[model samples]
Target: MDRFELFHLGWDDLWASQLAESSHAGRLGRISRVERGECDVLIEMGRVRAQSDSQRAQSAVAPVTGDWVTVTENDDGESMIEMVLERRTELVRRDPGERETQQPLSANVDVVFLVHGFDRPFRAGKLERFLVLAWNAGATPVVVLTKSDLARSEQRNELPAVVAAVAPGVEVVVSSIESREGLDRIEELLTPHRTGTMLGESGAGKSSLVNALLNTEVQETQEVRRSDAKGRHTTITRDLLVLPGSGILIDTPGIRAVGLWDAQDALENVFSDILDTAADCKFRDCAHDAEPACAVRDAVEDDRIDFRRLERFRAMAAELHESEQRVIERDRSSRSGRSHNGGKRRR
Candidate 1:
């Protein structure tokens, strides 16, 4: 296979120049999986396990799955990562309850599948929160409603409308791995060389979906408890799986809490339609509360928008803004501490 073909460069030619900055003079490899301090990389030569050396360590750059990196071999036959290429996209989330750090989920992804189970009715606020992170990752968000077969017949009928209310223009698919329904549609999105990440709460059928796509029991699946309907976390670490026929998929462990950090743009984009409607309001910064001539409130009153959905959006937006402020405050304190220590050392 040619270098481009072996490296899975389908439409990512723009990244070629950025990937050439390594010590190897641009010999590139794709990161398939990362564990602790090492990674499994796929290059033109084939799959090789490698780690970052001291020079790359100085940069504090952590390589996640799907990242293209430059690799070199030592006399001892150990390959080391010299540098990481600029990512086209990166999925990041605020460390849960810790506003000090950003957790990178994946890099260079083309799409994100926000999975949710029908056993528990979809929560508009939670969906909005996930979408914020997805949009911030620079990947298109597609909502996947899993476990459709578990829903009551009447409840299943209302699924489409519920999805439509929360996310407009975002593709929503109802899937049931047992019945194999909607698998083809999901497969179509996994075009060759494209990468996607799965995001959802624990037991939302993410693993089951991966198993279905691979057509094997690659990922373990367990039944949700009848009493609580919660799934056990079968996937302990994030693993990247290459589809036999097409693109790659990053399977992440179940996320219990998805805190937001610096996602103001994403939140605004998610609520753009409502913001557009609010432009006609009397005040420039209308809160959409009981303000006079409030277009958003009027729309809610006239049944143009669901009141619950609007309320959820407002609450999530506020929560994300608050979280961002906390992160900024934490950074300021850290900088102050560093400056104080430096002055003491000089004295």
Candidate 2:
């Protein structure tokens, strides 16, 4: 029945409604970092380490950074996470090296920063995957071109064009941690009580950007290899940190493999123009490869859609299809196994 400090941690009326209707009784808090079996939760009393095993009773899903949860004490006098509130948005991807598994990177993210370093090559395929991942999470995608200070004249101009091609109607900003250029554009989008996250490969500038915005050494920065420009993973785990008068920012570790997870609708949104042209193909199921009257291929040939753009679109679509097939196969096999075991699943 007492008041709680929820404004600084991205709480709003919607969350309050959920809290009022929640079946648990404890102090409301937001998860800052998740560890082995416990997590650091920021509560009305401040940050406290709480046992998270209590979460499994109410929700089957494990806790992640940026989750709003309730804390209570058990008979042993240890802080415990009672329950986790429903999430608004989640940045998800197919688990690395797993066919039909999903890895939730961050929860309740309002904005997703597609951070890429201008110092390295802008791999269109990799960046497009990031776009699809962000879009599928229903977050506002912003292309943040970091390390602009090291980029040459041509590199600076060329990178934005590629971003525009892959992500239409999305905002793009060129930024540098040293010069502090274009940081304001990214800051204006971080309104109070909102949540955003920075996602990119390790060698990219995600950690450096987080340190700059937070004005502290919240995350460590490492140098990339001179030969390959591959950076080490400085951020081992994801954590939700608060900004001064701004919203919360989730800094995640470098993601190497970005496979899709239920992103078919998002793929269409990203490449609607190309799919629209495919409507005129000779066959309804036309693959657009050497097919007669293929409007999609014609669009590429006539310079309507960039060649690489079309290629990335097709590649992502294929990946989604393969993911669907794997899910089906896994489910069928699971059903068969259960049937053989007399309707009981095996260990």
Candidate 3:
């Protein structure tokens, strides 16, 4: 590939300068796939295998697919990834149960498509979690309601408004992957130089939509089971792919649960109307429940805002608050354990 082709893979001067300033002398490459100790990276020359140096580092900073890294040739003429450049945006989620750590799914993405299927269960509360994930990643979130062809006419008409009501400023696309509805509009969003990824539960037709966008079966897809309307893990790993004539797209594995991780501010952004309405509350720190003059409660009573939306907002806010507390406690415990270990060493 030539220098011009590098731009299509999301490389620019900012990345070039970082690689130049680094002590390691090598080519700049974008990681396409990551294994236990090796990864496939795309460089100006071509895709090549490189070893990750993250394990030798003092901290856990392993590279994942979509990361732009500095790769250098070792004495044996093997490629080694030296460092990972700064990411503009990363799609991260809270690791399951009582863990304060986050699992980064994709890096340096411009937009995130939160795919939902009309044929499967549509939970607004679950949608709120995905919205927070997108907002926290610093990427524009677009709600893609897939499987429109299978949806009843009345169901198709009602779902978008309901999704929009919850998503606030986010765009909601109604599509049928089989019939190719809304494919053109989706393609427009995935313009050249922009990177996007899909986050959805199994059976949401994420891979099928990607195939429709690419106009080929680039990713394998399976049908949702008739009994539960659930889909198998079609896309096993989070692999980034270049769209036929557009930007890059990353298809991820199915997500079963969503745990909030330091998304307090994003919650306010997703539920901006509630925050705006709450500003008129009599108390500065109104909880909106049983308060004498809570504007949020008043709005709910007046039917200005749906009560369930407010309730969902409160639930997420509480979840984030608890997550914050847990992180603090975990850090304190780590420090205490370290201090104790140091004292023992001194003896």
Candidate 4:
């Protein structure tokens, strides 16, 4: 198979000049998995483990799964990455407690599966948060509702409406690994070579869903404890898994908290409906609080919008702004510390 075929590179026009140039030069491949600091790259030459260039490290450009890169072969049967082709999409989040550093989750992802557990119902705010990250990544977001079999019949009835309210123009699949339901729908989304990552809280059945897709127990699965409905963090790190018959899947360590970073645009996109309503408010810069003729407030009072959902949106927007400020301060401190150390050395 051609390298593109192996990497699931459909839509040839979307591949940028740098990626095409590397491919034409016969040095391009897709990163399947990143382990420790080494990468497992898939090329026309086949899968090989390669180290990233030390020069790239100086720029904070680390390779993650789905990154198309150039690799060089060494005499010792080892390979080293020479360059990272520009990515079409990048999944990132604010590093917890550190705002300035953007933690890259994956790169060049075509789709993001935001998994939620039925047992937990749905947190509208959390769903919106994930959607913002997905939108920012430039990948289409699909909601995967897991543990459907475990949900009470009434809760099941409420699932669709909840999803529709938060994720407009997005697809939602109700799945149950215990019964193998919705597996085919999920499989259809997996085209060979295209990459996707699973995002959700621990015990949301992310690993279980991946295992179901692969049709094997490739990942270790554990039950959520009864006391907290939280699963033990079985998957300690992010790793890419090649499905037996379909596309590549990047399974991430169960995330307990998903901090936001510079997601203002994303938040606007996710809540565009609310924004649209607010646009016609009496005040151009209205905070939507006690403002006369506020469309958003009107909607809330008329039951046209869920007040709780609106509150969630406002809270997330504020949180993201605060996180960005924190990141800025942290970066400033880091630079100051470095300068101080340099002065001491000179003295």
Estimated TM-score for each candidate? 0.88, 0.93, 0.93, 0.86
- Measured by TM-score, how close is model 3 to the native structure? 0.93
Residues 248-313, model 2: lDDT tens digits: 889889887688999999898888888899899989998888888999989888999888888888
Tens digits of per-residue lDDT for model 3, 189-252: 8786788899999879888887887788988999888998989877787777777787888888
Per-residue CA lDDT of model 1 for 1-347, tens digit only, reads 32335434333657765544434543577887888878887777767789766556465678888787878887687888877777788899887646667778788889899999988757778888888999999999999889888889988888877877788889998899979888877878878567888999889999899988989998887888788778788786677777767777888888877877778899888888788888899999788887899999988889987788778778877877787677788889999999999999999
Per-candidate count of clashing residue pairs (backbone under 3 Å)? 0, 0, 0, 4
**Which rank order by lDDT, best down to worst?**
2, 3, 1, 4
List candidate 3 segments past 4 Å from native: 1-4
- Which scores better on TM-score, 1 or 2? 2
Descending-TM-score candidate ranking: 3, 2, 1, 4
